[model samples]
Target: MSKVQAPELKKYMDKLLFVNLQGHRKVSGYLRGFDIFLNLVLDEAREEGTADKVECGTVVIRGNSVTSMELLAAR
Candidate 1:
């Protein structure tokens, strides 16, 4: 499979993104910034749990720990 390039994420800037991390953790937030390594900075981040969402103001996710990312509709 082709690798995800930084340029491909440009369109998602300032948009909501749902991120799947290793170990079944899931989070969603507005895209703030990123790097070639795929490390991401998200604003107003929130951890999604089975029953409720936990607020995480801002988070920087390590690239290697990311499993997948999905673009979400604007709120």
Candidate 2:
């Protein structure tokens, strides 16, 4: 299936990203891929909440749930 992500977002492919989702969930992952719907395919993904950080490997996130996204600087 061919999913097209925004041209702007394409720049961040294969880089670390900080993604904010609905319900106050924050995700940090390496952007492996994305689609037209803004759905994201992340590697070594980690989600953070008020309580703690949860590790999620090779995750595909639905576009509709994404609230905001930023490319994180590499250290």
Candidate 3:
């Protein structure tokens, strides 16, 4: 029998992410990991029925600053 290996996940490990904390100063940080963090944040908001209050944007993080901001337009 032959064995198959799944494709390795690419390193977006250091990519910067800017999260606007709802009018609070924007936060810039190394996105070492995010999927789990995002889910947790969302889940908590859902339980409190406050998820609708959150707004999110994706920004390319460079060092400790945001490099660009763009809304995802439909194709």
Candidate 4:
């Protein structure tokens, strides 16, 4: 059967997210904490590497201690 796509997904854009943290415990529940987490992550990623930054429709993070992260289109 063919799958139907959601409208929200259609408008989704890619983003390069970043987070700065030396230890693992520091980044725990970072995203759930507040808006700052999002900002921090995006900033860190840019510092780590030279990548294109864009708006992300959705952000999913795994692992407790996140040294860094880069957001991109989930293909």
Candidate 5:
């Protein structure tokens, strides 16, 4: 599998992103910032489940918990 580098992630700044976390949790938000460790700061974040979406405002996601991330179309 291809790896995502820091520079590559830069392009997605301020864009919407869908992130899959461990334990099947999912979240989506606009990319705000990230660190070398891949820890992410999301603006207007929300936790999404099968039946509901919970508003999270701004959140900081630990890099280790992230399983995958995908860019999403503008809302």
Candidate 6:
């Protein structure tokens, strides 16, 4: 879904999410953990770019630092 509410997040746990962060960085990963404030921990995260992506094992992102997040359709 393009718009994600708090409740929707929980239902989509362990699913893929595209996360936009500050400084024009974007990532997609399995949604491992999150909090009420939107702080997130992503597993098997991949940094998006024009070239080959850099594999990020795991990432913890602060709630305030996140710009947006989109739930990706399951494969």
**TM values, all candidates:** 0.88, 0.82, 0.29, 0.24, 0.87, 0.81
lDDT of 2 by residue, 1-75 (tens): 987446467678788999999988899999988877888998999997788989999899999999999889642
lDDT of 5 at 3: 70
Whole-model lDDT per candidate: 0.93, 0.86, 0.31, 0.33, 0.92, 0.85
- Per-residue accuracy of model 3 over 1-75 as CA lDDT, tens digit each: 976543231243444433444333444333444332232111111111233333343333222332332222211
lDDT (Cα, tens digit) per residue for candidate 5, span 42-68: 999999999999999999999999999
Please list the Cα RMSD from the true structure of every candidate, rounded to 1 decimal place: 3.4, 3.7, 13.4, 13.2, 4.0, 5.6
Residue 68, candidate 2: C-alpha displacement in angstroms: 0.3
Candidate that would win on TM-score: 1
lDDT of 1: 0.93
Which residue pairs overlap in candidate 5's backbone? none
Model 2, which residues run further than 4 Å from truth?
Answer: 1-7
TM-score of 3: 0.29
Question: How many backbone collisions does model 2 have?
Answer: 4
lDDT of 5 at 8: 54
Which residue pairs collide, candidate 3?
none
Question: Residue-wise lDDT of candidate 1 within 2-75, one digit each (tens)?
Answer: 97666468888899999999999999999999999899999999999999999999999998999999999675
Model 4 — which ten-residue stretch has the worst lDDT? Answer: 25-34
TM-score-wise, the better of 3 and 4 is 3
Candidate 4, lDDT over the whole model: 0.33
Between prediction 2 and prediction 3, which has the larger TM-score? Answer: 2
TM-score of 6: 0.81
